[model samples]
Target: MDLSELLDDLIRFWPVDVDDVSLIGHSMGGLVLRSAGHHGYEAAHEWTGKAKTYVSLGTPHSGAPLENLAHQASAILAARPETNAFGRLLRRRSGGIRDLRAGSLVDSDWQGRDPDGLAAAMAAEVPLLPGVDHYWVSATLTRDPKHPLSRVIGDGLVLHHSAGGRNSTRHIGFTEDNGLHLGRANHFNLLNDARIAAKLVDWVG
Candidate 1:
């Protein structure tokens, strides 16, 4: 649906003769980029063939733990009449916010699932583009990435592991070599920090 619409718009408006296509997105935008690429690849869209490099900055590919917590909290509140209103309000978060719960990038990932349910099964894995080089940048608030807090509350929002697209169920095919991890930084730092800019230069400049 939405992904298909994006793919169609991309095909319609983009130049046709570009030889190499490099894509970069931050936060939820990264997931959108992946969805677009995946959608194009699945449908044999011509642009998919020109895609060469993709980079995601602070994307919660494995899902955002904060959203999961909020979902759980909403359920608890909904169980009591005293807090039902609050629960309903929380559940009213936009679809884009809900999609962050599992980094869902395609229709099958959420089509038939109960919107209020927080089941792990709702997080279906979407395959990566076959020939595209995918890269990721993740950060943590602590000076040391190995700090216990970094692992649990990375960048104050997304977990370090999730940003890197790794979870107990699967690794989203990113290699250590293709990822960049920054410490003593928050999620937004991935957007314009000098280190990140340098890395981008090395990777695609």
Candidate 2:
């Protein structure tokens, strides 16, 4: 479902004080949280006003290079009949995967656009929820955060910079103190890392 539909479900099932709420999402889930928050904020939803924290783990705030490469590869393969079948397979990726190309969150990000088109630029910047603490966690596969390998092969799937929510032209406005970087770890490691758990406790426990 789209962000609007997901927001509708959240509104329907929310059963706590609208004055206080914490949102935590991992990977693509993080993008969903951002999208939902944006939708709620724009519509003046009660929950948006009270959202205290938003933590995104291993979210590709900037587009994922792997997906971008795959998107390009799919198109190139589709151009030739000899590899059209393989290209079709790659092109079969879900809308969610396509969204990852540029971390798209809202309908306008992809609305009226060609899904298979090579252009994967963000339609607009989705601002963070005002007055909410937005934190992000990133991981790298090298022991040192500054290592060149870590910079390029972050978490084996996402680039460290992308996970941190900053691109050349856009910044998610996360404060330095609100972010975490774990070296020698992969993306999934964010799910069960001790430091992350402790950080969560400190942030919202």
Candidate 3:
């Protein structure tokens, strides 16, 4: 099933009350949370009203270039008989992976298209839920924030700009105070960083 459908099922069967609930999404989980709250989705309004805070950790909010590259690589490999099997395996990505191509938060973002093709032309900008305090955390491999490696291999997966919700065409516009950058950290570390955990506690509290 698609991420949206899975999210819908999750929300539908939620046992606890959603009022005042705060969501913390790491990596692709962040995208799922955003998708659940996108206006294009029916559940968006319901969750948005109850959600107090939205925190994303090392999420590819502007799409993951790595995945895009992988798609291209897979296609090329699949064309060759020698690596055809391996390439075919790579090409057979889950619906969730396809959705990540453009950080799609709505069904329409990837409803009917070539899963292997470039990201679909976005129909509209998906805005952040109003009244919900949105937070972003990004990590960098370099110790210095200004290091060239920091920009190129941000967290070794997602770029700092993308994770921090900085987009050129569309604005997620999370306040400076709501965003944090950690140096000498990789993508996986964001999940267990004591500093990040503390911030989440503080924010949720």
Best by TM-score: 1
**TM accuracy, model 1:** 0.92
Residue 136 of candidate 1: its Cα lDDT? 92
Clashes of each: 0, 0, 0
Candidate 3, residues 1-205: lDDT per residue as tens digits?
A: 2544554456567997545757789999998787667742455534455668989999888877687778888888888999999898998888778666667776676567766664543524677867789999989898775688777778898888889776666566677789899999999999898999889888988
lDDT of each: 0.84, 0.84, 0.76
- In model 2, the runs with Cα more than 4 Å from the true position are 1-19
Error in Å for residue 91 of model 3: 0.7
Error of 1 at 95 (Å): 1.7
**Which model is ahead, 2 or 3, in terms of lDDT?**
2
Which regions of candidate 3 are displaced past 4 Å? Answer: 1-19, 39-46, 118-124
53-125: candidate 1 lDDT, tens digit per residue: 8999999998898888888989889889999999998999888888898888876777878889866646667
- TM-score for all models, in order of appearance: 0.92, 0.90, 0.82
Please list all clashing residue pairs in model 3, or write none if there are none.
none
Error of 3 at 166 (Å): 2.2
Winner on lDDT (1 vs 3):
1
